[model samples]
Target: MTKSAAPSTEYPGLFSPHQEPLPGALDGELLYSWCARFHRLSGNSKASTTSQMLFGHATTGLRHDFPGQLGYFGAATGGHLGTLQEIVQARTQFALHALFLDESTRRATESVFQGNDRSQLSRTLGLSRSGQVSLTPLKACPACIGEDRGTVLTGWWRMDHQWPSMYACLKHRCLLNVMANQGRAHWLQEWYLPVELREDQWAEHTEMGQSQVERLIHIARWTEALLHQRDIYFDATLLRHVYLYQAKARGWMTWDGALRFATLRAAFADSHRGLEALPGWEFIKEVGSVNGGFLGLLLRKHPGRRHPLKHVLLMAFLYEEPLDFYAQYENSKLILETEGPAALDRRLTDMQSRLIEMVESEGKSANASCLELGIPTTQGLRLLTRKNVAVHRRPRILTDALKAELEALLRAGTERDEIARRLKLRKAYVKDYLATQPELRNAWEQAAKVQLAARYRAHFLRVLEDNPDVPIKRIRRIGGNGFEWLYRNDREWLAENLPGIWRRPET
Candidate 1:
């Protein structure tokens, strides 16, 4: 509604008191987040109206947050805000900026990062729109919005959702809902509010395959990782090179180095089985053809920049990590292969890498690594004979001792939560571990009976013992309930334990 507001006549002349940006807001922030904060602090409504006085021209969209235009926001805010490099490193999704190979894109990005001249551009690097791929709806998580407002006092858009393969919130883990379907440029027409998202009207869940929720959790985490760290960056060309090389190693390529689509299809079908219904996943069918949908086009020299999520998924399927992919990509040309020494050397190198991966990468200890790798033993001496890898031999003595003590306690009728506390272990872990032990399992099965019988019997015995003069009838009356169960189930024990009970029970 505020879109038509003209700064020349309708609005205040200039932003007074040039406000400061939020504190500790470096890296991993969205452009829209700062803009919303900007308008709020400036005491204005529509940025389209207010920004004219600041940036010299009212602008919308990418002008607000991309690295090139960040200086304007800093200049208007009248504070010692960090440079555009810091802004891109911290705010805009510039970590993944290396994925675009177009030298023009690289140059434009460099222009912004260098903070040279703050010039506007027609296209954003790695930002997909109106080619093979369309822009995804702007995403907002209701839970995240509430969190940002309650803690930080604002609910701005996130760069995480803008990346490919991102469908859920990193914080809340619920699927993110999209904003208005029209141009996002309209978002700045008025003050943006968290309530504007209105997630109550959105879909409950996205289309997911079996165990996809768990899979998505890992993917979402990696997406954020990709956003923050500069450790992984490869354009489409290098990615294709990596994919084909890995595929070749796995026997998914022909003698002529062309992809054996049949092998790839079967393999992809097995791994990404239920995921075929996803947007890009649908393109897998075209692998054999020249124009192999998104997946096929990815292998081609220029497929017009597939989303980062696509690369992430492909990497997830093939490589241990981006580092591994990068290693192979860097090695393909240098490493000579044959059926002899070179091949054996590469094979050993690969095995050594795998060994390191089992221990360090997977964060598994020696025994665990040996067990997982199907090695005979985790002892360093034995492992040295097989492969040169250090196994973090976690001492099992403490764990064994804890288990033994917990089992003994469980068998003695201690409650699970109490046992966990006394042992400084988790209640769920105690329960699960207890279930694994024969003694504890048997004890758990009898816990109810033991609990009920012990409660009644202990009180009965205690009362009788404390007052030696007290009679069984008096104790039964004091016991209140469960006297019938004792009278019914343990008639013989009751007689033997309390001989006096037999003498006076007729009453």
Candidate 2:
């Protein structure tokens, strides 16, 4: 039988949010691209609407400006985009943090996904405040796009092609395209379909000769492998040791066990000969310089993270296979990373920085931040306060009855301090509230007179109702506060409403 047509309402996205299948995801499609697709489908005129709908607040810079805001994305959407299966795929299958970040950096960034409360989600790779990097260009594979069009699909950006130091596409064995006019952050401001192959543009970004082109392609494929091939995280220190040990064995390091900067730089230059046609090639060359220009940056004593491209390109030159690189790292005889008081000190310092960021930058509750960091409240709170990070607890809402009770206490001439203490509220807040409430002000002004009348009115009524024999003067005496004040303020009220026996004045 022929398949029946689905209902008109059976359409996806007819009722709620929808996401286009993440583009080029199997080969590392970026989360940022998926965010743009989601925004487009949302039909939101303002990009903030999409961000605010996903994240609790409307933060623009971190949303589209970077390739991944994994923690923030996971928190806001909770892995729900199209469906449960899609959520799993996008978060697990296509995630770059799991592959790119060093162990500590990955732990810090992925805290949000794991439901841990680290404030480092907004941070870019443990960079200091002064170390803000410029936004890199959004890159695309022109050949991939041209191929996609053959299947009637639009070209889209791929993560593997866009990474720093990746000069070509591993899949198509071709150099990637750069949209110079359209930078990374606002690329999603307008719809951007995948590009078709442009020979002129390709020539601009790539080298001409087959030999020069073939060499860069190897580096690109190696970078892609770095993103996907690793099943377990390797210690960056061990990796560094392995690289140095291999470099020494290959005679690429000095007799003093230092990186042979000139030789390595020469090799890098020789491999990608004439690639200066691509923008920023000079800077990469300078970083790879043998004069210790960026050598200390790549291999550090304490293990500072390097750009993924720097690690991959160096690995590409040093070893034929990624496994060979891993094998070298595994057999290294370097001191253990987790050892001694120095290690303890480093761990403590890292925790402090993470806590301060969580409370100060991420606006997490200080207590929750502490709990997530697995530290004690006393120590965490003390450290945060010492660093001048405000440990703000969530404000409790004032119930209507609390306001009424406060009004009552105020009317009864209770001290503001006593009222605050009794209600467990701030004195300033209570005072400010009373100043704003006209009803409370009115009650306060008439409280003395109201209390006087209330005292006399009850006694006066009981005498008339239950004891006709009781004297009116005695009833007035039993009422508290001054009888003269009541008489002067409420004489008419008393005279008109009292029983016949209590109606007349004693005089």
Give per-candidate clash totals. Answer: 2, 3
lDDT tens per residue, model 1, 354-412 = 55576666765555444333232434325444665545454434567776887777877
TM-score of 2: 0.50
Residue pairs clashing in model 1 are: 27-90, 28-90
Candidate 2 runs further than 4 Å off: 1-15, 18-28, 44-48, 55-78, 81-104, 112-124, 129-132, 150-152, 183-188, 195-208, 254-260, 276-282, 287-290, 300-303, 333-507
lDDT of 2 by residue, 1-507 (tens): 111122222322422223433222333345555655565556778766665554323543133334233333443443344332233234232233345455565545433333222234335344333132444456777677777676635455666566556667755667667755444554435434355334432334443688766667766655545554445565556566666666665667643344566776676667756765665444454645545444556566665654444566667777765546755654452334436334432332357788888888898777666655545566777887788877876356778988789888888866665676677565566678778988876676577457647766664466456645555654433322233334656778766764475655552
**261, model 1: CA deviation in Å?**
1.7
The TM-score of candidate 1 is 0.52
Compared with the true structure, the alpha-carbon lDDT of candidate 2 equals 0.54
Deviating ranges (above 4 Å) for candidate 1: 1-13, 16-27, 61-68, 99-107, 112-135, 170-174, 183-188, 191-196, 200-205, 228-235, 262-290, 301-309, 333-507
Listing every candidate in turn, what is its Cα RMSD in Å to the true structure after a full C-alpha superposition? 19.7, 33.1
